[model samples]
Target: MAADDHEFGGQHTDIKLEIVEKYLQRYSAALHTWCDAVWYIDAFAGTGSRTVRVKAKEGDLFEEPAPEYVEQRRGSAKIALDIDPPFDRLVFMDAKPKHIAALKALKASYPGRDIDVVRGDANDLIQKEIKWDGWKKTRAVMFLDPYGMEVEWDTLRLIADTKAIDVWYLFSLSGLYRQAARDMSKIDATKERALTRMLGTDAWKSELYSPIPPAIDLLGSLEREDVRQRAADVAGLERYVRDRLAQIFPKVLDPWPLPPKERPQRFSLFCAISNPSPKAIRLAEDFGRSIMRSR
Candidate 1:
């Protein structure tokens, strides 16, 4: 697919790329010394590039000129290929045919490199197709930048079971908050199922909601209503997710809310270490915290 066919890059997109690149560089360098192999997996890898629309500057004409578009900005796939002390294996998986074609083309550009472009659901590819037996001798870093809540909680548990891969998850905060509607009655069965699958549990209903107080009618009769309100706001939603991740991963850094400090946060960029070793957890958190703080 052409780069323009993919979603355009925005401020949040830029920040996500920057943070991942910083972690990849440090991760690859640190593991290259003793580890036999290190892998980089782009689970929702879009085309190897993104398009950025640059607004045209004011001109002499009454109406402003059309905005200019800039394409071919290096994405996570390309960034991984270019890292020094590079990862031994690179995997890019996407469900769309066009995206798969683009990833294959990207693989061709880096000839002789050990890169695998798989076309399938990210969750399925990780759980069923990818080999976990080799995980003992190898380490990996997987990037999960899903469009919405495509990632299943079971997949996260599988990754954590590997005990050798680190993960950078760009969780959709707005997606969760929106799907789990403010009014409990508004959430249908489909939305409830989706929320349960993503969160891996139905406990969110109780943790995130509160019951409405009973009222009395003018006729002196007490009235009881089956109503509930969402008690978790944006920040609360984010905290719930972080706590969920902590259940599986040994170390999860405090995610950096995207569009940084802005209202109605869209995504939470999280860095989690699956490795249980104290050294590994400490190193990953140190790098993750510093990178996010500097950003």
Candidate 2:
């Protein structure tokens, strides 16, 4: 698929880069403070690099290769997890054979690393593997960016229950809600399952039939405090998720929830979930604030 066709890079800009950079900085720094080794996992890893234009020293700009974290110095963090084998330690797993082949070629380019480019599903991989035995003291950040809603909630629940991994998930409220609301019959089963997992309940089913306006309208109203306080309510929902995570892992910190309006161009929501430690909370909050400030 083309970069522009993807929801993440469709409207690629510097702000998108900034939001990811902030999280990478905090995630990397936190791992460094906690353990001697850390692992970075991108469950929905794309073609390793995206075509984006960044500002240069000159007056003009040019399209170049950019990964999820471009600002940070290379080797500052450990392995990158992606379905594409751009890195040596890349764990490229996908349902498509072509994707696996692409990752294989990419992996061959980089030699001498623990790369596991399996042609399978990440949810199954996580269920069977991604343990906490050897990684007891080590920190791992899992980036879940599905194309639509193929990610299962049970998988996420299991991952969260482990308390050994922090998740940087892209919740496509607008995208998924829009599709499901428009055509209930057309909604993919995988997408529905993923939505259920992310919402932590079946409450969304009520919205399907409810006279709720379009997602754009709802988000617009949410932006205004006078009209039923939609934004506040959405923020509350995020808090609810954060609290639930805290209950599962008391050491897990309150998630720093960034609403879609904050970065309407790049994402609808950007939340950071980590273990409940003072340092972790601070780092998450700092990253969230940086995202808001960047806008």
Candidate 3:
């Protein structure tokens, strides 16, 4: 996914949106001063608005359904466009035709702005198209907000290899919890493939899908308890992913486990900046500190 690819549900601080807006506002100002062009790339970008089903309260309607439907929120693409002193160019990518059509319509709303809508898998398009050009003397922000394990590790490595873009990745820790079966051997093959893709390795099966050893009881020969260690939040996944990111990006700003309200069940936004400046570092650290304070 290129941009605005968040899954809708429950309550949120809307911090995810806040983070994007803040970063863009800061990034645009910084880039505009020096860089000839700045690009905003949103992969896995969803349609402008999603039709959400909301519970209808009492006295709400003449004959409203129990769950009322409404188009409630603006997607990232729209939000990014709305930012003042916007990026010099914007790129939107998605696998859905409807989303592509929506993006095209969105393009119409801002007639003169430079925007490109690539209808295809974000992983492939990013590696083949976006990453290849527009990066010379250009600073770019790529928001990879996929709904699932659509972002491949190889693509990330490629981005790092270029070392010209900043990445805002939505890591789905909840998906890991779902696939991390207690009995690892019995996990479905398809899910296993997804886990491997997300982790960029098959070793997670051995690394994370294991039980915590039993502690010694009063009787030395017998174990005290059978305590099975499972995926709880983003500990295992975060460490592994961040370690990999560290190998590439010098600065990986993860205001991780994000505050619960903004966190999607177990998902969090992770940022990887290629070659960060002092101001970028300041903004990233400030954001993390703010989130921690709120927590």
Candidate 4:
């Protein structure tokens, strides 16, 4: 792929980017008064831009149709840099080397901005590397747009412990349902471990599944299938995730459902407030709710 060509989608991608951008613009401006420094952290920062393919419509009989091509669009990292009252320090982390290189180039483009591009897993980087308690008077907004189950529960706990950062988590509802397979026996050791780690609890086995209804066997005996199946549907699973987040964060706003309108729920966009103060929580909730409702 080209340097500026990070993988992205169509309408949903545009909506996700817009929500984050709107929140960042408000976040920086609001915190500038009380807080000395504000930070913007993009956990899975993609090249600071993305390549979107624009499809062409059918042309009239009089003229030939236009061919489809690529277009460069700003990702969350670039959006953060463009905010009116910009963040004091911006950190962009990605596991890919190419993405890191692209982020570096993006940093170079903004000569005066304070930007740090790190190459590492978001979970390990957030959990082990960064100093959470060191931020005394500083506040931050960390965006977690992970690539399928990458954000561990431990990482979220660490972010919450900071007590000064707001989180915009783009959680994969589909990813969770898929990992926790419907057939209980289908969950292998690897899948089991992933579910527990991502959820921070082994209780999912009980919470998400149940045994099937009893059925009559060929031998004319009532038989119950020993294997369990996933009981929670998509909306139920989304609620479970929101509840999990609420346990860690002081406040979690109702998720903005993705693939908008009547489509099946694929991803859920959540805004969680880590700040423990009552006043801070209230204000963050208000801001988050307004932004989501507008979208």
Candidate 5:
């Protein structure tokens, strides 16, 4: 039976297809040769399907693209990972039971494909046995999209230190900033710790003191354009800590840096990281620009 295309919907759009496409393009460009394997891990794999509308250039008409259509087209780069059970694999993890089950069912329908669906907390699961053999010195993209601020800092640190995986994470600053800024004392310690870790310092509190325009101003002053771009770049860095991550991992490749106008959301931020390769950053910028153009 052919695999179902509309299996993972009703979930919010974390990072859109354009961003993923650019990452794939950049990763492919940076590699000297075809990669031995590549892993695309989705930590919050919704129902495994989504429906999106594309506007027609001529008319007010909009066309809906099936989730499978988008996945299959952009997923070509993933063929090696799925074929022959290549050491490279695509892993989808989600805390939700229904989402996990749906992913498992979808995997079953696609025989000979090496897609692993696990039900568990991504933070805890990363600590478990994971085969990084194929990932060593190779590129892997991990999509970290949590519902809110629940993602653990430890997990991000572990992944960052691995030097193997380039992270594309979604940090919902609007949600957390609104909640935490109201009463710092009332916020959960874990959430506070996670925010601190994400920012790489307690200095974020200083934003309240400065007359500058919110968090974007502080982030933009950093020497690293990647850091500055991520913060003040099109989507607004405070929405996500692109600048902070770039600051913490300065040794890694600098980001391509998107202009504010190119980002998808006026209030959100999106960026990418790779091991000592500007390819990821460039791709991220291209993706960001594409998203803006699409709008």
Candidate 6:
């Protein structure tokens, strides 16, 4: 893939990437003994490795000598491909056509590997079209990394409902909540739908806004108002998403109890583990705590 063709984020994202690589490595090893064929599915897989400009900042997960453009980091697609004992099957889906072409090229690069590339909405494709005949027996690991709050809650439910798959989700809190102004005067229609899809319901309106005003009087702090308190803040919203996932997933693993105060604009990596094993607990609890303590 061309250098400019992929999605770009801050160098801090590599911390999350390294966690993903570590989890994939340990997870596959632990399950390979019992499962016959392990699978890796990336719903929002980028072209491959993208560019990340590294700069020192507070709550930074990665450290570097100086602020420079990073090139050694590979995207999820490449990292998963390099895992030991490797996945039996690899599935990649992205809404962008260019990303599909990029994946197709990767398929050409590795001719013998079993890789399926689909171009469409992952919410529908993963739920309806993707065949899980082998998945039920061997098990699967899915990575859902959407740009904003594009991933639907029901899609998460469907994946967790399998009882075998484990998921790593990047829930973008800053991107979604910033869509609406601080005031409750006006709301964007498209953002309204996106928020509903992300949260699984319109309950966020009542949770985030105070007094829960009617549609006609959605103006100012008089009747319908914005909650200026920390209770309606971004951290609160992130926690709410995790709580929603806990209802379906038996074990919801997150490194932080709340959003990091230093990087409020960044997304938090959440691991929704199903059918938790001993290794899973160590990875989520022990490892997660150590990582947070280091920060």
- Tens digits of per-residue lDDT, candidate 1, 14-99, equal 88899899999989998998897999999999888776656566666587666666555788899999999988999999999998
Residue range 194-273, candidate 6, lDDT tens digits: 77888788876666666433334455436534333224566666777788888888888763422344656467788887
| Local distance difference test scores for all models | 0.88, 0.52, 0.72, 0.87, 0.53, 0.73
Q: What's the TM for model 4? A: 0.93
RMSD of 1: 2.5
Two-way TM-score contest, 2 vs 4, winner:
4
Error of 3 at 62 (Å): 22
Per-residue lDDT for 1-295 in model 3, tens only? Answer: 2344444633432567667767777677777888888889898777755444455755555854454544457777887888778778999988988789889999999989999988998888867865555566778888887775678887887877666788898877677777866655557899888878777788776667556676776767656454444454456666777776777776898635545554445776788887556765665567556545654
Stretches of candidate 1 exceeding 4 Å from the true structure? 1-4, 59-67, 222-224
Sort the candidates on lDDT, descending order: 1, 4, 6, 3, 5, 2
- Worst 10 contiguous positions by lDDT, candidate 3: 4-13
lDDT of 5 by residue, 1-295 (tens): 1334433212234234445455545454444256766666777666555434433344335854434323322222233233332435678887878667767776776677678888888878985644466456566777675656666656766676666676766666555455444334445677666666655566654432223223335557644222111123223445235555665442333223322234343223345454545654555456556655654
Ranking 3 against 5 by lDDT, winner: 3
* Candidate 2 residue-wise lDDT, 1-295, digit = tens: 3422212344332343445555665666656754765666666665444444333533336755444422321111122532122222335566666556655666676666566667678788877786566655666666776665566666677776665566766555445444444434455777666567666666555543333343436546554232111222344444544554454554443333334345432234445454567766666677677756765
RMSD to the native, candidate 3? Answer: 5.5
Clashing pairs in 2: 222-231, 251-275, 251-276, 252-275, 252-276, 253-276
Question: What total of clashing residue pairs does each candidate reach?
Answer: 0, 6, 7, 0, 7, 0
Question: lDDT: which is higher, 1 or 2?
Answer: 1
TM-score to true structure, per model: 0.93, 0.61, 0.79, 0.93, 0.61, 0.79
The list of candidate 2 runs beyond 4 A from truth reads 1-8, 12-14, 51-90, 179-198, 206-267
Candidate number achieving the greatest lDDT relative to the actual structure: 1
